[model samples]
Target: MHLPEIDRYGRGHSPLHRLDPRLKLPALGVFLLATNLTWKLPLAALFLLVAFLLTLLSRLPTNFVLWHLRAPAALGLILAFLLAIFTPGAPLVGPVTREGANLAATVFFKILASFLYFISMVATAPLFRTIQAARALGAPEKLLALFLFTYRYLFALLDRARNLSLAMQARGFREKTDRRTYELKARLYALLFLRAYEETERVLLAMYARGFSNPRVTLPQPLTSAQVLRGLPLLSLALLLLALNFFW
Candidate 1:
């Protein structure tokens, strides 16, 4: 299968792209941990700034990064609305209380910071490399294998579904706000599931035929001194955040 444009950007010759995936992966973990633990807005803003710098260092398209953030931004807004309406506190403005607004704002910034951190981490390396790095960091092999398979097949499944939708459209299938549309969608979903099951069976058979009974194990490449040094800045930033969380 052809690589998606979003995935293709990871192959760029940038500092972040060049960092060892093992180093990057753990650094991302610490960064995320620090971000989640931070409650103060100033600290969260710092984390966001770090995420932005990392994005720039990765040399990914700015528009692509912004587009990628849209889902998280939408979800954050929804969460803020729910918190403002549901959280119990004395009213500050309209239905929203001061405490509720503060909590919602905190959650929104936290989610935004996390989304940016993830995009920076994932965009800096190919998917397979990220999986491998997770394995190297002692993630369960079975879990990693599941992640690998899902990532590998998600696009293919989407393509199959798209083709099916296009074929239906060509056959004059017009969706409407009615029972017929719902029934057609249900049938389409069932057919997609069946096709996916059959494809999975074929893949398993092919794997068995090739004597692939066990998952192959390979050690991740060791990080060099220079690579470790290069990663120290991220680590230091995470530590600084953690220190602030504890002391501030």
Candidate 2:
């Protein structure tokens, strides 16, 4: 994984880290809006340039973002190539049609913007803070509840899988084990799935017994107007650049 999972995401020390997740979350949303509002490639490039600088300012290593980009890069390359071949617009080069290539370029930029926005958000905000911010931003209660359950259950699922794997190893099963070992592995996987399901059910029943109705995750108080005010300058600068791109 690009990050060390939950730990790397919650550094919480730098200025960017210390800023309210509420601000960070909206900043990312505005950034996305700006990214899409302009079709000018150079303008989008500038947004990316600013994002690059922010990553550095946030004290995250370049690879921290780049590592996460691997999946996006692969997906983008595939989609770009397919769009270049199939979609029609302008000729890119001799024999290769222009229309297809131009649309492909647009797709690549769109994907890049999405990837950068998502990865940068993940790198800077702790998972819990991000969830809290999402809730604060008026995310639906149903969605919030689902996210809460998912966050807790993911680690639980992983722990169960690890235990199952260890039990198999203890039984003298290795990759080189015979065909019978294959059956044993399948059974182990079945048992793991069953265990995870039961555990989730148990958790739900326990929560219900405890009067859990709405999601109960705690977040530090919502960001004040003054706190949000601090990011205004940079946000304004970003919006200005985005606007200029269309006219210039």
Candidate 3:
């Protein structure tokens, strides 16, 4: 089962990549909150610039970030279009109302800002380390465990589905826009579910046999003064944005 790589750029020597996740996670939350709280165009644009700079600093590929943004961009366009046609306010140009246009622009910038922050904060870290940070931040134990297990098995499930599709193709199965194709896809889903259930049962039994009671997740090394110093720029940026949101 081949899994698609995550955080491909995370192994780089960039300082942002090396920053501790425990600090990064909280700063990300604050940044997201600050961006969402503001409707001012200039402030939103400032947040967008900050997000772009952070992404560049992380050293992730430009194509990777843009590719991941397509969905959000599409959704933003749809929202803007809806607002232009449906919002109640004085007309700005043509049939578009001033209030709706303003609202749409705000939503678009907010989405862009939040998406870039997510890429910088979450996509730049190894999955396990992110989970560790979540646990350190006092995430509920059951929720953490569930998240860990889901992430661990997600690729395996994708691999299984890919293999099944390949086998079907080798046996001369070709999809058509018809009932037969729908039925075949339905059966494939059922097969995947049954396989997943059996695999989960086996794993649970193995864990029980190994006496895996109260699984303990170890915390990362204690944050040093230097690490805190290195992370101050991000924390300060978030604080500044929060201040601007409230006082500006």
Residue by residue across 1-248, what tens digits does model 1's lDDT show? 33344566777788888877888887788888888998777777777777777777788888888888888999999999989877899998898988888888888888888987787778878777777888889988888887777877888898888888988899999989999999999989998999999999999999999998877535678778998998887777767766777887
In model 3, pairs of residues that clash are: none
lDDT of 2: 0.71
146-246: candidate 3 lDDT, tens digit per residue: 77778778877888889888988999999999999999999999999998998999998999999987766667778899989999998998899989998
Score candidate 3 by TM-score against the native. 0.90
Better of 1 and 3 by TM-score: 3
Ranking by TM-score: 3, 1, 2
Model 1 residue runs over 4 Å out of place are 1-6, 85-93
Task: For model 2, state the Cα shift of residue 247 in Å.
Answer: 3.5
Q: Pick the candidate with the highest lDDT.
A: 3
Stretch of 10 with least lDDT, candidate 3: 1-10
TM-score of 1: 0.87
For model 1, state the Cα shift of residue 196 in Å.
1.9
By TM-score, the best candidate is: 3
lDDT of 2 by residue, 1-248 (tens): 11147337567566677667777777777777777776655666666677666666677666767777777788988997887777665566754567766666766776677667656655677787788777788877678778878766777677778888887788777785688878987898899889978887898899899998777656579567877787676567656755676677
lDDT of each: 0.82, 0.71, 0.86
lDDT of 1 at 108: 86
